[model samples]
Target: MNAHEIVAAVSSRRASAVEIVRATLDRIAAAKALNAVVTVDSERSLSDAATIDRRLQLGESIPLAGVPVVIKDNIWVDGWRVTQGSRLFADFVAPCDAIAVERLKKAGAVVVGMGATSEFACKGVTTSLLFGSARHPLDPDLTPGGSSGGPATAVAADLVPLAIGTDAGGSSRRPPAHVGIVGFKPSYGAIPYGPGFAEPFFGISVIAPIARNVADAALAFEAMAGPDARDSDSALVESSDVDSSDLRVAFSPKLGLDTPVDPAISERLEVVVEHLAKTGLRSVRRDPVWPPGATEEALMPLQHGGLAELYGAAFQKDPEQFDPDVARQIERGLSLRGVDVIAALGASSAITTAFAEFFREFDLLLAPTVPCVAWPLAQLGPKVIGGKEVSPRVHAAFTPFVNHARLPAITIPCGCDGNGLPFGIQIIARRGRDRLLLRAATRIEDEIRALPH
Candidate 1:
C-alpha cells in the first residue's frame, strides 16, 4: 500500500501498525539481493509500530500513522547504524535522530532501516566499501544511480512506500529518475538538515523526499519542513496556488550548459512536452545566461575542500579506509589554496544570481533529469552519451545547478528509453516556491500518465 492508504488503514483502526511493519519487514528480507538497505532493526521497528497503534487507540491523529519509511545512511536515526558507506566509520551509530527524522517519527512514520549511500555521499553511484552496490529493481545488472541510490531503490522496489535522502548535487533526483519514481529537493532550507554526519556540500545540500508519487513526496516534505532553533536555515513558508493559465514555463533541454543528452532521452522529453502543451501547459525555449566559470568543475572545490576539512586527518592516518575515488577528491582538496575555494564560492553565487534573474521571465524550467538510462553496476558513469565521449560527471550536468541555486525541483517518470529503462523530466521553480512546483508537477504527472504508451 502507498503511505496515504497505510495511514488511513492504521488511523481508522482497520489495521494495526505492527501488521503493516511485519509485512514490510518480510518484503525487505526477501529483497536482500538488491542491497538497497544496510541495516534493519526489526525489533525496534515493531516496538515503534506497537506504540503508534496505542496512540491511535487514544484518538490522536497521525499524518503518517504506521507508514514504513527508509532513511538514507547519511541521515541519523537514533541508535541506528549509519556508515555513510565508508569502512572507516563502519561501526558508527547515530547518537540521535536528525531533525527531519525526529519530525517523521513524531508524525508516526516507522523507521524500517538505513538505506545505503556512497562514501560520505561523495559519489554519484550508490556503492561503497561497506555495503557493496544497490541494483535497479527492474534490472538487477543495472544501477539505480547514487549517493541516494539505496533510498531510491527502497521506494522503487516497494521495500517502503516513502524514503528520505539528501540532495546535494542531485543525489535524490537522479536516482529516482533511473528507478522511475518521484524525488523532490525542496529549496535548501525547506527541511532542516542536521545533527548528523558532516555535510560535504554544506549550505547547498538539502534533505529530500522520495516516493512512488509526487503527493507522498509532498506529504513527507510537509511533515519534515519547519523552523528549528538548531537549524538556522530552516523556516516555515506558506505555499500559494499558481494559476496554470498564467504560469510562464521555459523548456531548456540543456539547462543552458549545452550538456549532451542521450537521443532517446531527448526524444522522450520532446514527446512529453508536446503532450503537456496539448493539455494547456505550454513552454517557450529559454535557457539561462550563465556567467563565465559557472560549470560544475568551477564549483567543485567546495566539495573537495569540505571533505578535506572533515576527514583529512583520518585520511592521512588510514588512506586505505576510504573509497579510492573519494580518496582522490580528498587529496585534491588538500592541495587547494584558500583562494580557489573563495573563487568557487563566488561562482556559486553567480550561478544563483543567474537563476534568480532567469526566474523573472519564467516561473518554471523543464529539462531531462539525466542524459541517459541506468547503466551497468560498478562503474562511475556512462563513458559516452549521445554518441560523444563525456566526463564522468556528464550525467550530473542537468542537476547540480539546482542545488547551487537552492531552488525547488522534482523528477517524475515521463517515458522509457528504447532499452525499456526509465528516465524522468525535471521541473524546477524559483527558490522558496516549492508549492508552486509541486502543483505543476502533479499536473504534468497526470498528463504524462494519460499519454498513450
Candidate 2:
C-alpha cells in the first residue's frame, strides 16, 4: 500500500500502527543480506508507533498518523546518526531533523529507519567504503540504482511504503526506475533543504520522495512540500494545478543524441508512446538535450563544483577519512577555476532557458528513465552498451538535468525491458508544475498495459 492507504488503514482501525511497523521490520530483517539499509532502529520505531496508538485511542487525528517511513541516510533526523553514506561524518548524530523529515514526523509518520546511499551520493552506484554496497533486492547480481537506491530498494521489497530521499543527479529518479517503483522529485527545494545545510553552488540536488507508485509519491510530496524559512529557493505558492486529460508529450527514445540505447528500452519506450498516442495525446520527437541550451559539453565540470560546495564541510573535517571515490570527486570539483565555473554556469543557464519555449509547447516530456536497464553488479559502469562507453552517470540521463534546472520530473513504471529490469518513462513539467507531472504520470500508467519484452 502507498502512504495514504497506510495512513488510512491505520486510521480506520483496519490495522494498527504496530501491525504496519511489524511487517516493515520483518521485511527489513529478511532482506538483511541485501544491505540496502545501513541502519534499522526497530525499537525506536515501535515506541513511536505505540505513541500513535495512544493518540488514535484518544481520537486525536494526525495527517499521516501511524505511517511507517524511511529516510535516506544522508538527511538529518534527530538522533538518527545521519551518515550520508560516507565515513567522514559516520559518527555524527544530527542535532535536529532535516526540514522534510521534520514535516513527515509532524504529519505523524513513524520513523522506521534510514536507507543506504552511495558514499556522499557522489557516485552512480550505491556502494561506499562506509557501508559496503547496496544490491538489488530482486537480483543481487544487478544494481539497485544509486544514491537513493537503498530507500527505493526497501520500498520495492515491501520493507516500507514511503521513503524520503535526495536526488542531485538521478539519485531518486533512476533508483526507482531500477527497482520498479516511482520516484518523484518536485521542482527543487519543494520539500526544503536545511538549517544545517544549504543549496549547492549549482542547482543539482534536492530532497525528494520514492514510493510504490506515482500517486503515493505525490501524496508524500504534498505532505513534505511548502515554503520553509530555511529553504528560500522553494517555489512560491501560486494558483495552479495538474490537468486530468488532453496531455501533450514529446517522446524521445534517445534524447536526441546518438547514445548507445539498449534495444529493449528503445522498443519498450515506443510501445509506451504508442499507447499514449491512442489517448489523443500529441507526441513529438524532440531532442531534450542536457545542459539545456548551452553549446558546450560541460555538465561534469560544473557539477563537480557543486559537489565540493555541498560536501566541502566534510572535506575540511576529515578529507583523508572520506570515501576515496568521494574524495576524488571533491578534488575534481575543487580544481575548477572561476572561469570554468562561470562558463559552465552560463551553459547551464542556456540549457535551462532553451527548455523554456519547449516546455510551453509540451505539457510533458517523455523518455526512458535510463538509456538501458540496470547493468551488472560487478561492473563499475557500462563498458559498451550501444557502441559507446557512456559515462555510468549519463546512462540515467533523464533526471539530472531536471535537478540541475530545478524542474519537476517524475518517473512512472511503464514496462520492463527484456532483461526483466524495469524501464520507466519520465514525465517532466514546468518548474513548480508537480501536479501536472503527477496527472500525466497517472494517465500513462493507467493507459499502458505491461508489455512483455
Candidate 3:
C-alpha cells in the first residue's frame, strides 16, 4: 500500500499505526540480510507512531498521520543519528530537524530512522563508516545505486511506502531507476535543507522523494515543498490542478552523450517510448539543442568541485584514510581556477537558455535516466559502458544540469533490462512545474504498469 492508503487504513481503525510500523520494522529486518538500512530505530519509531495514534484518537486531522517515512542519513532529524553516511560523523545525532523534515513532521508523518547515504553524498555508491554498504534489494550482490541508494533500495524492497533523500546530482533518481521504483528530484531548492549547512552544493542539493510510485512521490513532495524563511532559494509555487491534454515532448535515445548502453536495454527503452507515443501527446524526435560542450561541462568540473568541497577537510585530517578516487577528486576540484568556474557558470546558463527555448516547443524532455543496464556490483567505476571507459561521475552527469537549471525532473520505472534490473525514463519540465510533470508522468506510468512482464 502507498503511504496515504496505509495512513488512511490506520486512521480509520482498520489497522493500527503500531501494526503498520511493526510490519515496516519486520520488512527492514528481513531486508537486514540485504544491508539496506543504516539504522533501524524501532523503539523510537514505534514511540513516534504511538504519539500519532494519540493525535488521531483526539480526532485531529493530520495529512500523513500514520505514515512512516525514512530520511537519508545526511538530512537532519532531531534526536536521530545524522551520520551523512560516513564514519567521521557516525555517532553524530542531530540536535534539530531540517526545514523539509520539520514540515513533514508538522503534517504528522512519523520518522522511521536515518537512511544511509554515500559519505556526504559525494559519490554514486552508498557506503560509509557507519553502515557497510547499501546492497540492492532486488539482488543483494548488486548496488541499489547511490547516494540515496538506501532510500531507493528500501522503498523498492517495500520497507517503507515513502522515503526522503537528497540529490545534489542524480542520487535519488538513479537508485530508484536501478531498483524499479520511483524517484522525484524537484527543481533545486523545491524543499529547504536549512537547520544544517551554510549552503549545500552552491544550491544543488534538493530534498527529494524516493517512492513506490508517482502519486506517493507527489504527495511526499507536496508535504515537503514550499519556501521556508530560512532557505532564501525556495521558490513560491502555488498549487494548481494537473491536466493531461495539450502536451508536447521531445525524446533522445542518447542526448548526444557517448553512452555505452546495452542494446537490449536500449531496445527496451525504445519500446517504452513507443508506448508513450500511443498517448497522442505530440512526440518530436528532434535533435538535442543542448549548448555546445554541455555534456563535458556538466561532468568533470562539478564532480571535482563537489568532491573537493565535501572531502577536502578529510584529506587534511588523514590522506590515507580517504578513498583514492575521492582524494583525487578533492585535488582536482580544489585546483579549479576562477576562469573555469566562470566558464562553468556561463556554460550552465547557456544550456539552460537553450533548453528553455527548446521547451517552448516541447512541454517536456524525455531521455534514458542512465546509459547502461545494471551491471556487476564490483564493476561500476571500472567497466567500459557504451564502448567507452566510464568513471562513476560521468554516469550521473546528465541529471545534474537540471540542478543547474533548477528544473523539476522525475525518474519513472519504464521497463526492465534483459537481466531484469529496472530501467527508468526521466521526464523533465520547467522550473517549479513539478505538479504538471508528475501528472504527465503518471499518464505514462499507468501505461507502463499495464504492460505484461
Please state the error at residue 255 of candidate 3 in Å.
Answer: 2.3
**Candidate 1 segments whose C-alpha is farther than 4 A from its true place:** 240-245
lDDT of the candidates, in the order given: 0.92, 0.77, 0.77
lDDT of 2 by residue, 362-396 (tens): 77888778877777776656666655677655576
Candidate 2 Cα lDDT to native: 0.77
Compute each candidate's TM-score over C-alphas: 0.98, 0.93, 0.94
Clashing pairs in 2: 168-205, 260-386, 292-351, 293-351
Native-to-model Cα distance after best TM-score fit, residue 349 in candidate 3, in Å: 2.1
Ranking by TM-score: 1, 3, 2
Candidate 1, residues 1-453: lDDT per residue as tens digits?
Answer: 999999999999899999999999999999999999889999999999999999998999999999999999999999988888999878898999999999999999999999989999999999988879999999999989988999999999999999999999999999999999999999988888899888878599999999999989988988999889999898765556545557999998888887788898898888988888887889999999999989999999999999999999999999999999999999999999999999999999999999999999999999989998888896899998999898888888989999999999999998887878999999999988898888899899999999876
Superposed Cα deviation of residue 34, candidate 1 (Å): 0.4
Model 3, residue 186: distance off in Å is 0.7
* Per-residue accuracy of model 3 over 177-272 as CA lDDT, tens digit each: 888888999887778767864323665678899898898898888888888788788876645575557887888777556567756557776777
After superposition of all CA atoms, the RMSD between model 1 and the true structure is 1.0
RMSD (CA, Å), each prediction = 1.0, 2.4, 2.0
